[model samples]
Target chain A: MSQDQYFIAVDWGSTRLRAFLCKHSLNANIELVARNNGPGVTKVSDSFEKTLFDCIEPWTTEYGRLPIYLAGQIGSSIGWRETEYLPCPISPEQVASKCLIFEELGHEISILPGLSCLLPNQHYDLMRGEELQVLGWLNQRPENRKGQHLICLPGTHTKWVFVNNGQIIMFKTAMTGELYDILVNHSILIQNKTASFDQAAFDQGAKFTLQSEAGSFVHGLFSVRSKQLFSQITGQQSTSYLSGLLIGSDVRAAINANEWNVDSLDKIALIGAPHLSKSFARVLELEGYKTEICKLTQTTLAGFSSVFRATESSLITTS
Target chain B: MSQDQYFIAVDWGSTRLRAFLCKHSLNANIELVARNNGPGVTKVSDSFEKTLFDCIEPWTTEYGRLPIYLAGQIGSSIGWRETEYLPCPISPEQVASKCLIFEELGHEISILPGLSCLLPNQHYDLMRGEELQVLGWLNQRPENRKGQHLICLPGTHTKWVFVNNGQIIMFKTAMTGELYDILVNHSILIQNKTASFDQAAFDQGAKFTLQSEAGSFVHGLFSVRSKQLFSQITGQQSTSYLSGLLIGSDVRAAINANEWNVDSLDKIALIGAPHLSKSFARVLELEGYKTEICKLTQTTLAGFSSVFRATESSLITTS
Candidate 1:
C-alpha cells in the first residue's frame, strides 16, 4: 500500500500557484484527492521551507506520506533552489534525474527541471510548466502529436511555440496581455472604459490593419484615440479599432515573417484564458485558419500528472 | 516706420504663445520680439482679452503699435473668436481671412483661417499654422516644390501631411510623443529610475516590430519591462528599445501607407525638435527616402510669417 501511494503535482506561475494530489491507475485515470496553496516560490519572501510546508500542510494532513512533484518556477534558481535545465529532445528518464529532491517535515518533495532548447550559436530558450503541459497533451492525444504544431500559450507574455516530435523547436514571446493593460489603464485610449471585450473595436482595428498600407500603424493608433476624443469615432467602436490595429498589425507581421505557413492553418492550437483564446481563435479563423482552444487547467493538470508518472516510472525501473 | 514693417507672425500651440516681428525685406530677417504663456486658449482660464494682452504686453511695450498677424489654434472657436476653415486648392489670398477686430485693444489682429481639405462625403482634414510652413517651403523654393511631398511635423500629436501642387491634399496624425511619455512614465515600461536611450535595445525592438512575424504591438510591449525585471534585459537598454519600438513602428506604418509617393524620395521633409526630428529623418533615410530636417522653431517662424503676409495682403486688397 505504501509503495502504491500516489504523488502530488504543483503548477506555480508568476501570479498564481496551484497544487494537485493524484493517484495514477493502470488505466491512466489520475484521481485528484487533495489540493492546497503551496507557497508560490516566486511570490513569497519567507524561507522556501516555510512556503513549501504551508502549501503542503493540508495535503500532508490528508495523505500523510505522499511524494510530491513540483513544476514551474519552483525549479528556478531563485525558487526552491537551483535545479538545472534539461536539454531538449530529452526522454522521460532524463526528466526524472532533472527533478531535484528535498526532504522536509517527514515528507519528500521534488521539483522538476524545466526544458531548454539551444540553437547552434544562439542563446537557449527555456520553459517550465509549459513543457509538462505539452507532454500531457501528447500523452492524451498520441496519434495527433506527430506533425509540427504551433502552440500559442497566451497570458502576460504570450508564447508562440513551435513543437516538433514532442520537443519544443523554437518559440517567440508576445506581451499582448501586458500591452492591453497598459493601453487601457495608461494610454489616452482609455476613453473606452468598458471592461468587456469590444468586438466592434476588435473587428474594426483588425480590419484596419489588414487593409492598411505598408506602414500605417503609427498613424492608425493616433486615430484610435483622437477620433474618439473628437467624437469622429464612437467610444465603443474605438476599442474595436484599437484592437484591430494591434491584432491586425500582429497578424500582418506574423504573416510576413512566415512564422506559420499560410497553407498550414490547421496545425495551430491556442492555450489561454477562455476569452483571449477564443478571440485569437476567431481572428485566426477569419484569416482561414482552423484553430483549437486547449483547456488551460486541464492541460496544467495533465502536465503535472504526466511529470509525476514519468518520475515514478523511472524510479521503479531504476530500483 | 509703419511701411518698414514687413511681416508679423504668431505661433500659438497647446503650450506656449509667441509673436515674431519680422522685416519682410530682401533677407526676410525674422526677430522674436514678444513671448507669453498660458494663452493657448486650452490652458487659459482667464478672458481672451486678458490672454491676448498678456502676449502682446512685450510688443505693446516695445513697438507701441505694429501690423499684428496670428496663426495656429488661436483662430479656432475657443481662440481669438471663431474663424471658419478655408477650403483646399486655396492660394495665399483665398485662405487669408479678415483679421478679428478688438475695439478696446486698438490693434488689428488678423487671424488666418486654417486651410482644410474636404473629402467629398467623408470628413474634412484641417490645419492652422502648418499650412503657413508648407506655403513658406513652397514660396521659398518654388522650383523645388513641383511634385508630391510628405511633411512630418512631430510633437504632442505628430502630423504627417501630404501636399501636392502647392495645395494641401491630406494628412494623418500620430501620437508618438504622447505614447512615449505615457509608456515611460505610467505604463509597465516605467524604468522607475531614469534611464537614457539604449541604442541596442532600440535597434532590437525596432527590428522586432520590423519583422514580418511581429504580432500585435501590445504583445511585444511586455518584453520591455519583463526582460528588465527578470534580468534578461538590461534596464538602461529598455528605454531605447521602447523608443525604437514606438518610433520604428510609427516609421514602418508611415512608410507602408505610402500616402505621398511622388515616384521618388526627394520630397519628404521632417520638421520637429532637432533630436526627435533627426531620429525620424534617420529612419526615413534608411528606408531609401530623401529626408530633410526642417528646424522646428525656424519652420514655425516661417509658417507664421507666411500666414501673416498672406493675411496682410488680403487686408490691403480688401480694404
Candidate 2:
C-alpha cells in the first residue's frame, strides 16, 4: 500500500447526492477533488456497489481506493443499507458505532448513523446528514460549545436542533420549505412570478404569524394575492409576507414548545442558503433574538470533514 | 303545468353539486329532491350545458320549469356564463343586480353574484357560494346581527369571514384541508397505518402552535411520526398534534389579522362537519373565545333557500 493517505466523504440527501475527495496528511488541506451525480441510493437499483463505483469512476485514477465516510439519507431505510439511529444526547462514539459498513471497491466504506432524540412521553426528532454539519460546527468552534445553541438547517424538511455541551439534546423538523413549494406551485397562491424570497412579505407574514392564534396561519395566506391585487400590497411583498407567516409561525411554535430559550437568541445559527437564512434571521432579530447565518455549503463541507477526520483517526488507532 | 308553487335552489361547490326543492307556502319546507356530481365550473369543459343539465335532471321534473337560483362557483367566469361580482357591504339588490341570467331547459335560471371587497390600495377578497350561506345565517338570526361576528367555514380552503350589520366586511382563506391531505397522503409524513386524532396530542399541538414562532409549523410536522414511534407518543396523538398545530395556527392567524377581541367569544360561529367544527370551536373555547357550531349542511341549504326565495319574488313581481 502507498504511504499517501486518501479519504472520501459524501453528503447524501433526499433529492441530491454529493461526494468529496480529500487527501489527509500532516499540515494538509482537505480538497474536493471529485464530484458526480447519479441515482442516489434512494433512486437506483439494489446494486449499491455498482452505483457507487460508477459514480466515482472519474476519481479512481487518483484516489478511488480511499476509505470513504458517508452521511445523510444514504443510511436511511431506502438507502445503501439501513443503519440504526443513535438515540439523542449522544457522543461521537455512539454515532460511529451505529455506522453501517459496506465492503467493495477494495476500500473500507462506512455510513454514519443519524442522531435521534426520544423525549419522555413525547415525540422524537431524527437527523442524518446534518449530524456531520453539527459535528463540523462543533469542530470549528470548540470553545463556543459551552452554551446551548439552536441550529436551523433549512431544506425540504428543515431541522431545528438543540445542542448543549457537545451533545445533541434534542431536535425538531419543519416542513417550511415544502409548504412554500406547495403553496406557490400547487395551490392558488401562485400569482407571484419571481422565485426569489420576498423579504417585505416574509417580514409581514412572520409578524402576523407570530402574534396570530395557534391555528390561524392558513386563513391569513389568502390575503397574499388579495392584498396585492386590491390592497396594493406588492406581489413581492405579499410573497415575503407569506414567508414571514410560515417561518414566524414555525419559530413561534418552537419557542412555545420550550425547545429553546429566548435568552439564547445569540446562539441561533441558521445553516442554509444566504437569502432564506438571512430572512429567518431577520425575523428572529425583530423578535429580539440574536441570530447568525452559517454558510450552507461550508457548514455541510466542514461537517463532512469532521467525520472524515474522526474516521481516519479510528482507522489509524486500529491499524 | 299544475301550479304546485315549488322553488329550486342549487348549492354548487368545488367538489359537489346539490339541489333543494321547496314548496312555496308559508313554511316553505325544503327537501333535497335531486343531487348529482359533475365537473365544477373550474374543471368543466366548454360543454357546460351538458354538465348542468345532468345535475338538475332529477329536480327539473318535479319543479316543472320553476324559478331556479344558483350559487357558488357557478357565478365565476367559467360557470353558467360569467356573472359579475358584487362589492361587499352590499344589500340583496346588489347581489341580485350582479346575477347572470341564463335560459336552460325551459327554466329561468339566475346565478347569485359572488361578493367582493376592494380595499383602497390593496387587493380584494371575493366569495361566491358561501355568500348565500352568510345571507341565510344573517336572515335566520336577525336578533344576534348587531355586533361583529367571525364566521369560519372550514374545508379544502377554509374561509374566515367577518360580518357586521348583515354585510360581509372582509374575509380570508386558509388551505388547511389541502395541507392536511398533502401531508397525510403525499408527503414524507405518511405512515402506513392510519391514526385517529387524540385530544391530548391535539391540545398539546394547539398550545405549542399558539406559542410558536413564525414559519416553524411547517418544520415541526416531520417529528410527528418519529415522535410517536421512538418517544412513546401514540401515532394517533401525533396526528392530532399535527392537526392541532395546523388548525390552531390557522385560527391564530385569522384572529390576528382581524384583530378580533376574544372577550366576546359568543360572536364566533364555526361552520363545517360536526366533528371538525366542534374541534375548532373547542380550540377557540380554550382561548377564552365564545364559539358556536354552525351546521354546515343547514347553513348551505338555508343560503340556497334565501337566494331561491329572492329569485322567485323577483320573477313574480316582474311577470
Candidate 3:
C-alpha cells in the first residue's frame, strides 16, 4: 500500500502570508496537517526564504522538507522568486505545467503562475492568487469542468473569471475593495472606517446603482456623500453604502462588458474571505445573479493539492 | 456720482486663499486693483483674521478699509465664521440678501452663503465657492438671465448647475477632481504623481470611458493599472489617461444624472481655472456639447462685484 504523500502550500500576497502543511491520502483526499502565518512579501526584511522558513520550519521538523507550492503575489517580481504569468484559456493542468519549480536549501518549491488576459473590450486584465482558487473551485466537481462558468474572487483586486470546458477562458479584475479601502482610509467621503455594516444602507446603494439609467458608477459614488449630507444616510451607514455602490457598479459593468444576462447564466461562484464573498453575493443576488460563496482556504488547499499530486505522480513515473 | 466704490473679493478655500482688490466701475465694470495670496483656512494657526490681514492688510492700508466679500470654503463651518447655505432657485440678488455681513476692527466683511439644492433625484448637493462663479456666469450677459442653461464648474468638487431664467434652479456635485487627486497621490494605480500630460493617451482614455456601454467608473479605473502592466500604456501616459478617464466619466455621469441629451442642450458654460475648464471643454465638445470656457478669477470678481454692489445699494437705502 502507498503511504500518503506530504506537501506545503503558501498563499503570500502583498499584505499577509499563510502556509499550510498537507497530506495527500491514498484515496486522493487532502488532509491539513498544520498551518502557519508570516509577514507578507513586502514586509520581509531579512529575506523571503528566512520568513518562509520561520513559518514552515516547525512543519518540516515534524515531517521532512516536503515539496512546496506557493501562489499569489508571492510569484510576482517582488515575491520570493519572479514567475511568469500564464495567458488565459489555460486549464489547471496547464497552470501546473508552467509552474516555476526550483530547489532552494534542500526544499523543492513550485510557484504557480498568475493569469493574464485581453478582455473582450481590448483591455488587459490580470490576477495572481485568485487563479488557484479558481482551480480549486473547478476541481470541486467533475461537472464543473464541462460547462460555461463564471467565478468571482472578491478582495482588494476582485477577479471575475470565465471558464469553458475546464479552462479559464477570460477574466476581469475590479478594484472594488481597494477603492473602498482608499476611499474610507484616505478620501474625504467617510471619516470613520470602522463603522458597523448597515444592511439597509448597503442594499439601498446597490439597488440605486443597479437601477440607474446609464449605470454611472462615478455618479452613484457621489450619492454616498450627498445622501449623508441630506440626512438620508448616517455616518455609520456611509461606508456600507459606498461598498454596496462599488460592488453593484462592478457587477453591472461585468455583465455589460461580457453581455451576460443575469437570469440566463450558470451560478457565478464567489471565492474569497467570508465577509467579502458574502458582500459580492449580496450585490450579485440583488442584481438577480445566482451566486455560491466558497471559502478561500479550502479552495487554495484543493488547488495546491491537485497540482502537487499531479507533479508527484509524474515524478514517480519518470523515476 | 457713485465714485466707483471698491471692495476686496476673497476666495478662501481649504487649500489656498486669494484676495483681489477690485474697483466697481461707474458703468458696472469691475477692475482689479491688486491681488494677493496666502495660506488657506486650514493653515491659519493664529487666527483667520490674522491670516486675512497679513495677505490684504497692505491693500486695506492703501485702499482705505474696503468692504471684504468672502466666498468659497472660507464661509463653511471650518472657515473664519460659519455661514448657512442658501436654498436653490435663488438669484444673485437673493444670494446677496442671505449674506452674513459683520464688522470686525474697522472693516465690513460679508461671507457669501453656499448654495444647497435638492436634486431631481432627491440627492442633496452643496457648493460654496462655485456659487460666485455661477453668479458671475449668469451676470455676464442679460440673455443668461432668461431661459435654461447648464453651467459646469469643474474643480475638486465639480458642480453641474442648472439655471432657469437667471436663477440657480438646482445643481449636482461630482467628486471627480478629488478622486483623481487621491488616486494619483495615495492609491496604487499610479506611482509617479508628477507625470506630464499626454494628450493622445488622455483622449484615448476619455474616449474609452465615453463609449463604454454601462459607464462604470470603478471598472474603468482598474484599466489604468492593467493597461500599464500589459504595456498598453506607459507610466507617463498612465496619469494623463487616468485624468481623461475621470473627466470623461464625470461628463458622462453628469449628462446621465441630469437626463441630458448632449446635442439638444445649450452650450455648457465651464467655469474654473483655465486648465481644468479646458479639460472639461475638451470632453464636453467631444460629446457634441458646445462649451464656453470661463476664467475663474474673472467670474469670481464679477460675482463678488455684483453681490457687493447690490449690498452697498441696500445699505445706502437703509442708511
Candidate 4:
C-alpha cells in the first residue's frame, strides 16, 4: 500500500487563486501532485466558496476529503473569511496555532492570518501572501530557522522582511514593481515599445540609485524622459533603465533599513519567480549582497506544512 | 490718438491652447482685453490649422490683423509646426529672433522656439511655455535680470529655471504632479474618497521627503498606501498627504540641487495657478525659502511683449 496521503495548499490572493495538491510522504517530504488555479477574490467577489470548490473538485474527488490549508488574501475581509491579522514578532508556530478553522466540504479548512507591524508613526505595515513564504523558507530546512536572515519577496508589492531565530521580527514593503508598472504604462517617462529586457539599461538605472545628488526618486525619474528626448536613451532602452532605477531604489531602501547593516545582509534569501529574482539578484550583486533564490511555490507549500505541524494533532485526523 | 493696440498671446501646449487678448499701453504694460481657449495639439491632431483658426477667429475678427505671438508646445513637432528648441543660455531676444514665422489670416504669426538645456549627462532638458515666463519675470523688472535668480513654475510638470543677466542658464523638470495624478488614479496607493485638500496630511507628506534615511522618493511613496491600509491616514487625507509628499520631495530635491545653495535661492519667483502656487509656497516656507507667486497670464503677456520687442519691425508689419 502507498504510504502517501494528499493535502491541499491554497495561496489565494486578490487577483488569483493558486491551489497545489501535494503528496505527504511518511518521511515528511511533501511532493507536488497537481496544481489548479481559479479566479481570485476580485473576480469571484462574494462567491469565493463556490469558486474555490469548483476549481478544486477534481482533486478532492480523487483524494477523498483531504485536509486543506489556505493563506494570503483568502483570509482578508473581502475573501472567504475575515481573519484578524496577528501582530509581528510572531513565529510560524503562532501563525499555525491561530489559523481559523471552517466547516465545509465535509472536511477541515484552516486559513492563515497575515502579519502586521505597527510603525513608529502608528501606521501598520502588512503582508498577506508573503508570511507563508517566510515560514516556508524556514521550513525548507530546520537549520534555516536559526540565526538572523533577511528575506526578500519580489512581486507586484516587493517586501523586505527581517527575521530572527525563525520569528518574523518586522518588515517593510516597497511599491517598486507597481510604480514601475504605472510609470512605464501610464506616465510619459517611458514610451515602452517592447517588453524585451535590456541588461545594460537596467544596470544604468541601478547605478543611478546610488547617486544621492541625483535628487529623490521623484526627481530622478525625469532622467528617463530627458534621456529619451535627448537621444541619450531609446524608447526600447527606457524600460530596462526605469526598471533598474526602481529596483535599485528598493535595494537602496533596504540598505538604509535599520534592522541590519550591509555586511549583516551579505547573504539574503529571496522568494520569487526566477525571472523577477534575476533582476533583483543583479541589483543585489551590484550593491555587494549575495542572493539565494527559492521557488515561490516550494516556499509556499513548505510554509503551509510548517503551520500544519504547529497545529494540534486532534485538529487534523486521518481519513 | 489712441495709445493702445491689441495683440494676441497664446500659451500653446500639448493639451490646451490658451490665448490672451491684451491691449498694449504706450508705457509697455499689457492689459487683458479678452481671453480664449481651444483644444491643443493632441485634440486637434493633424487638423492644427483648422483648430488654431477656430480658436483665434474671434480675437482676429475683433482686433484686425493682430500680430499673434505663440509660445510653448504649439511649436513642437506635434503642434501647428515644428520649431526647433533654442539651446539654453540664450536670451529672450534670441528666442524672439528665432521665432518661426508663418503668414495666416493676412497677418504675421510668430512661434517662439522652446529652450533646451543639455545636462552634464548630455540628456537634454527642454521647456516650452516656461521659457516665456522666465523672460517675462525678467521683463517685469529689467533690474531683476541684472542678477542670478531662481524661478519655479509648478504644473503637470514642474520646472525650476535659473536665470542670469536676462538669460536662462539651465532648468530641470520634475514629474511630481503627474506622478501624484497617476498614483491616486491608477496605482494601489490611495483610494482617495474625496477631492478635498487636508493641510495637515499634506504637511506630513512634505515632511517625509526631508528624511534622507527614509530612502528615495520611491520608498517613501509606499507609506501613503501603508498609512491608508493601517487607517493611520484616511482616504480623504491621502490625496493631500500624497500632494505634500510629492511637493516636499520636489523642494528637498531643489535644496539638494547643485545649481545653487538654499540660501542663494531665498526668494524664488513662482509662476503658476493660485491654488497650486499656494501649496508650493507652503512647502517652500516650511523649508526656509521665500516664494513670490507671479500671475501666469501676466508673465505670459510680458514674455510675448519682450519677444515682440526683440522682433524686427519689418517682420511684424502687414504684407
TM-score of each: 0.83, 0.84, 0.96, 0.94
Q: Give the least accurate 10-residue stretch of model 3 chain B, judged by summed lDDT.
A: B256-265
Q: Indicate the docking level reached by candidate 1.
A: acceptable
User: Mind giving the per-residue lDDT tens digits that candidate 1 earns over B1-319?
Assistant: 2545644467776566765666654345455544555457578778866876776676677767666676678877667667766766666545555445444466766766766654332334556667666666656567535667778877766777776667667777667888788778765466554787666677776665565333345545555754564465687777777877777777776665555553465657887778787777766665667787777667766666666666656667789
Chain B TM-score for all candidates, comma-separated: 0.84, 0.86, 0.96, 0.93
Provide the TM-score of chain A alone for each candidate, in the order shown: 0.85, 0.89, 0.96, 0.94
User: What value does the lDDT take at residue B73 in candidate 4?
Assistant: 82
lDDT of 3 by residue, A1-319 (tens): 2578888999998989999999889888998888989888888887888888889998888887789899988899788788888788788888888889999889999999998887667877888888888888888889889978888888888787888889999987778888888888877789678889899988888888888767466666778877876789999999999988888888887777643444556698889889888988888887677888887788889898878877787787889
lDDT per residue for candidate 3 within B138-162, as digits (tens), equals: 8889998898888998888788898
Which candidate should be chosen as best, given lDDT against the real structure? 3
DockQ of each: 0.42, 0.45, 0.64, 0.57
Which portions of model 4 show Cα errors greater than 4 Å? A1-5, A120-123, A212-215, A312-319, B1-3, B212-214, B312-319
In model 3, the clashing pairs are none
Where does candidate 1 chain A have its weakest 10-residue lDDT segment?
A117-126
Tell me the tens digit of each residue's lDDT in model 2 across A1-319: 3444667777777667677666655543455566666666667674867777766666776654777777888888778777777888876555665667777758788988888876542556788788877777766677646668788777666788888887778888877877777666666666765746666667766776666555455655676666664554676566667777777866776666555675754657888878778877887787777777887766766676666666666877899
Scanning candidate 1 chain B in windows of ten residues, the lowest lDDT window is B117-126
Per-residue alpha-carbon lDDT of candidate 2 for residues B1-319, written as tens digits (9 for 90 to 100): 2344676677776666666665544465455544556666667664766777666677776556777777887767656666666776776545665667778878878888777775432446777777876776765667546677888887777777777767677776677877777666666565643776678878877776666555445655665667555654665566677788778877776665634554554658887878778778877777777787877767776676666666666767889
TM-score, model 2, chain B versus true chain B: 0.86
DockQ-best of 1 and 3: 3
Interface RMSD of each: 4.6, 4.1, 1.8, 2.4
Two-chain complex of model 3, DockQ on C-alpha atoms against the true structure? 0.64
Model 3: lDDT of residue B233 = 88
